[model samples]
Target: MFISLNVKFDLFYSILAPNVIPDGFVDGRQVTEKLLEATQLDKNLYQCGNTKVFFKAGTLAHLEDLRDDKLNGIISLFQAEIRGYLMRKQYKKLQDQRVALTLMQRNIRKYLVLRNWPWWRLYTKVKPMLNIARQEEEMKKAAEELAKLKEEFEKLEKLKKELEEQNVTVLQQKNDLFLQLQTEQDSLADAEEKISKLVLQRGDMEQRIKELEERLADEEDQAANLNEVKKKMSSEIEELKKDVEDLESSLQKAEQEKQTKDNQIRTLQAEMAQQDETIGKLNKDKKNLEEQNKRTQEALQAEEDKVNHLNKLKAKLESTLDEVSLWTKWIFFNIFHSLL
Candidate 1:
């Protein structure tokens, strides 16, 4: 191929080589030179001239093959970019569709469950009574109120247990206080009769407490029923409140104990007229027990108030809970500490 491409050859020396040249500098000869350089072919196969090039016939075919391969690759790259963009756009739309369907399914399920409950039926019926034209998002208000009521009912159940235990403690405390009063007022017939009556009343209270404890298990089941918890819980709470009121009745023994102490004081004063020191000491003891009993009565009354205001007590149990907790612990405190 090299020996065949010399200017001495008729093809190279022909008028055709000068015909393929530049700008006239960029015409046939320049195009031919660039193509020849890209192929790194034997230079003898072609000759460039001032205005033209001369080449063997098959040389132009090599340039044609390179051009076709380059155009096909660029077109393929453009097609791949467009295909990727379309696939990503379609995938994003599909993901959004799936998410929307999931949310719709979730919310609809919640609404259906809430609507099917017995509480929901009762709420829908009685909504008018509360003037429940739902606003300020009143449904939200109703839901909050429902949660608050449930919390109160739970606290009441706990309080009922505490008060029952504390009731026994209070009764036992009263018994001890009166026993002291009995010792001091032993000579008085009136004091003796009253103390005997209180003892009988305490026996009746113990029997009543036993019956209430047996009833506790049954009521506990009713309180736990979620479907009827709202309406039935309120009715159940009212009955428990009555039981608490009966608990309050037991503390009346305190007032009777007060009378017994007063009588003892007077009898001590008259009998120990010369022994002024013993009289003063007995009087001092009476005053301390009175103060303690007064505070105890007030605390029980406050517990009753908390029972009534269980709804109002969102968080503030304050010292009342502390005192209530101590009620059981200090059950023996009065028996020993007060005597000492």
Candidate 2:
């Protein structure tokens, strides 16, 4: 029965190693080492007889030549190694399958919970809160509208009161101004009546003054004429006095002329002697004129010499002017050449 168990173990190991074993079974450090060592051994080597002996061999010739005890021992050892490798691989595969199935179950449970979560939260928690928030918003809007209305009402009341006061003030000021205007009108009428009376009195005074001015002008003219008449009378009296003195002087001169006629007869004899003396003086003056004519000819010769000297000076001035003109022409020619 032990040998049969050993054969079954060998068959199981063969199937597990080639087909049934999972890759994760050899992932551990210790199991990987054993798997690698077993893979290196010759697959054809075996131990077949009772109390088998093992061999390390690769070719069929080497395996066939091995002693029966060595061959059987090698086969049994290989079978044991293969059994241990397959058991560990099966255990690791079962563990991984268990873990995969558990994870799948957990994911299924999470999917179910998430799928219902929103509906539960909305019905149980959020609906009532949203309704309360909407009510609060409406109440806030209504309160704001009420506040605005109240403020407008107060402002309107204040404006109405101010308008009433302004109307009363205007009416009072109008009444006072009307009374003052009436008083001013009465005073203006009295002043106008007084001005009219004064204007009449002024006209009468102006007429009297005009009449007095005319009378005064006439008296001044009469006085001026009287003064002129007095001046003329005084001048006539002076002329009459002068005429009397002339008449008296003429009467004295007539008496003196009668006495001078008597003296003229004596003077006529003295004049005949003086005429003879005058003829001798005339002959002496005629001889002096003939000497003066010779001296005048000598003075004329001296004046002619002065005239010739003045002519020579005028010729020298003309020569100097010609030289100045030539020099001016030369200077202008030189200046024009330098500029070009």
On TM-score, the leading prediction is: 1
Best by lDDT: 1
lDDT, candidate 1, 110-157, per-residue tens: 879898797875565444333323332444554565556556555555
Off by over 4 Å in 2: 1-136, 208-340
Candidate 1, position 232, lDDT: 58
The estimated TM-scores of all candidates read 0.25, 0.22
Report residue 105 deviation for candidate 1 (angstroms): 1.6
Residue runs of model 1 more than 4 Å from their true location after superposition: 1-32, 114-340
Q: What TM-score would you give candidate 1 relative to the actual structure?
A: 0.25
Write model 2 residue lDDT over 1-340, tens digit each, in one string.
1122212233333321334333321212233223323445443444332222233444324323333445577789999999999999999999999999999999899877876776664354334443444545644654555455556555555555555555555545544543443343344444444545545554554565455556556656778766565555546545545554554455455445534543442343234234334434444443443344344444444444444544454455456556655766887999999999
